[model samples]
Target: MGTTLLGIDTKEHCFEAQFHPKRPLLACACITGEVELHHFDRENRTHELAQSITSHSKSCRAAKFLTDSILASTGADKFAALSDLETGKQVWRCKLKAAGYSLLALDTERFAIGDDDGGLRIFEGRAPKAAVSWSENTDFISDLAMGVDGTSLCAVSGDGTLAVYDVRKSGEKGLIAMSDFQDDELLSVAILRRGTKVICGTQTGVLPIFSWGDFGDQKDRINGHSMSVDAMVKLAEDSIITGSSDGKLRVVAVHSKSLHSQILGILGEMSAEYPIERLSLSPDASTLACSSHGRPSVQLWSTEAARRLMEGESWESIFEVPDEGAEGEGAKADPTAAESDDDSSEEEQPKKKRRKEKKKGKKNVPGSNAKQHQAAKFFAGL
Candidate 1:
């Protein structure tokens, strides 16, 4: 099982949670229009509220770490603001034409926000106004991702399109390409496979893969989840951690050559009770922070633990189901047995209980030898 390092009860739903670029701090944008920073001590396995700032008049929809000392946030109040993390004060605030739904940090000196009216705006460091704003998407922009070079920006929208822009240019000249409308709304996006592929998470649980420059249509699709993939973060060039509407977080491996993908492992033994809303990986890539829709708490998990399981011999067992047939056979054998034997001594009864418990424990272990051997064969073929 993956280790849960900490859980913070915000008492209000957190729309997003982001980790500091250099410090062991987490920033959360909440439904109450508040932005909170929490300081965590990994050695002691504890966390405390460091600061809280009222950022918006309405729900803060997204937040991103612009630098080690600055956090950028946008909200339903139609405003975007930058706050100084050390002083816990607003650096500058700007009112947009519409409510901002997604935010992305291009670099320490520049950032971007996508608003509810399909507006995409880029703002230079501490600027009170957008350097440039445009409306290419016909619906709300659900997510935004920055390319590896920091010059290319991508946005996924509720209108079922993926739009790309060149941060170096402005207005229509910056519009690189806009994809054809897909069957489902795009919720999240990531640039993967060394910037050769753009992966867009859809409302229907499919990942539409677009070739870097070819946004006309999806080159491939990976139907990996049973519910909507609400959020995703690239862990490696070929792997990503996806949070789904089914409340499960899974590590998936993407094969560029074969245009195939598979679930490498799941983050936890059991799914959360609510849909996952956001996923943020720490700068060092050692920790992951997650928040769920309608949930009042944020969970921090050990990323190393997940990586260890993925690379371990029992990786395939992460999603294994219990052997119901074996369990049923055991149940049948005990159906007519008495709860306690009247003729037996108390000492004998205790010993019998111990043996039964040991036997039950042995039966619950995942992946038998045969199953493991088969898994090896299956992966070899891949």
Candidate 2:
């Protein structure tokens, strides 16, 4: 068992892209403040650009689909907005004074927003009031993720500090401050192993894990990456999918009942020529999208088989194509390509004719406006 590479046709780079929890949808926040939502036609084995949402004034750092129809995005312009995916209308927008860089959608009225000035604010929906606010050093808060418990959250800082917050407690300290590992600034943080452990990726490719409530020492420290981790998302309870400055996607296996600390190997690594700016994974963990820095190029990887490999299977290569059953997805790529190179020597093909979708009599979902027009075409030739 190995990995399959899905080539997404796009000429835009996103800061981060995410798949809907229960829908066949992919949404990305682009560098130009335009959020692109894509619909994957699984029945037809095709995809189309569903909508291009332009609401932010600056580059959006994070975009996520709260429901199949509701989307949330945080921009560098110090604004966090919630949009109705079906109607394409901004439902609520929060304007912060500091430059906001990260966001996590809780419920309709609650969100965890991180800013460049090292501020993490939990505010009610549509209301400009803060319920819980936490700030560490002046380091920029790069990313924010919810703990498995649903009430607690973790905020990773540019100063290599991991701030844990339990909404139940109102103290400023909140409990633990893991500050020993300062090899480089931490960029991404993810809680794994059923929310019992906290794992973070650092600038120098260091993956450190801390037990819940006790962040004084690392439970396990895995190494081998030569660049900073730029994007990370949880693939499984014990597995983490990471994209780094070197454009490499790795399945880092943490300690668990069936596995030890291992680097299971690369999932969808391209040439290190272009650093990976953002990465997204489907709720089923079937699809993975990795965006490159300034190249306007992205790769969608299938991790179904890769999970098998992580489960202790051995494979020579995980770079096969799903439909063609080809030996290598990047077969035409130079063998000497960098960490995550691609097959870019091919010519672009004309757009595929629009296929009429299957009509269902049920009421349209909230994000149906996204289905009316194909905003952008990705992997037009694939």
Candidate 3:
């Protein structure tokens, strides 16, 4: 079973939650235009409210730690502000041309924000204005990702296009490449495979893969989820954890060859029971934090536990829903099994029926277990 270390009830809908890059602190952006900071003790499995900063007048769409001591946030109010964590004071604020929808910190001194009008601006330090700004996307930018070296900036947009920029340049010179329009809206993005691949999650369940320096078309696609992949975070060079509208968190391995990329297998999974909206990995990569749409809580899971579990057994065997008869035996064996009734009740019947229908409708695909074996071998290497 996936080990849930902690859960926090914010009493309001949370749009995003992010962990500090170098601290045990978690910041949450709320629909009320507020930012809450919490300090967590992972070993003790406890979390306490640290500080609450009223950073925006309207819904705060995103919040990120520019430094261990500085919290930056952007909101639907069309403003971005930086807050000092020690004093809980707003040190810097700037108004934008449109409502800020996404934010990314390139480094301690540089940060970027994407707006509702397809505008993107990069600010240096706490400058009164953006040092560089551009509008290459035709719609709102949904997410932003930075290359490993921090010079290349990539943004995915609702217009179904991906835009890459050279942050070191300004004006038209900064625009590195723009992708052709995709069929589905791009919601989230991540740079993986040592900066050779750019993966974008779409409105559909598919993940479109773009090769570095080549953005005209996707090199490959991975259809691993049944619903929209709303959020994702790279866990390793070849692995990423994706949160989907299907209400499941899955660790997927992306294997790339000469010109194609495919999913090796799902290494681990945990059910959240709601559409996941945001995901964040701890700086140490030992914990994962996530928030779901319309849910007033944030959940933290132990990544170490997940890794150990995958090393021992296949992900499919670990998370597979048992037959109804087996559930009764499981409940009898573990008294606390009743606690999961709420999550499993709605899915149990339909899932079983679907499994039966799949078995009867078509011949089982060959080499299905080969993926599982490959996943086991991959985990061993990790």
Considering every candidate listed, which one attains the maximal TM-score? Answer: 1
Question: Residue 70 CA error for candidate 1 (Å)?
Answer: 1.6
**1-382 per-residue lDDT for model 1 (tens digits):** 4557777767577878999887888898887888988888877888888899888888788888888888899987889898887787888999999888889988887889998767899999776688877776666778899877667788887767777877877776777666656757788998888887789887777888887766666888876576678889888777778877666667766763432466655674123446677898988888888886433468887776456544543443543435553211111221221122223222211111122212222112233223222322321211
Q: How many backbone clashes does candidate 3 have?
A: 0
> Which ranges of candidate 1 are over 4 A from the true structure?
256-260, 269-272, 294-296, 309-312, 316-382
Worst 10 residues of 1 by lDDT: 329-338
For residues 65-156, write the lDDT of model 3, one tens digit per residue: 98888988898788989999889888999999998888998888888999876789999888899999987666678899997766879988
Candidate 2: misplaced stretches above 4 Å?
Answer: 1-5, 9-11, 42-45, 168-178, 294-296, 317-382
TM-scores, each model vs. reference: 0.80, 0.77, 0.79
Residue-wise lDDT of candidate 2 within 212-292, one digit each (tens)? Answer: 755544667887666777778888888888877666677777885676776666666644576676677766767787876
Q: Each prediction's Cα lDDT score?
A: 0.71, 0.64, 0.71
Question: Superposing all C-alpha atoms, what RMSD in Å does each candidate have to the true structure?
Answer: 16.7, 15.2, 11.5
Q: lDDT for model 1, on a 0 to 1 scale? A: 0.71
If ranked by TM-score, best first, what sequence of candidates would result? 1, 3, 2
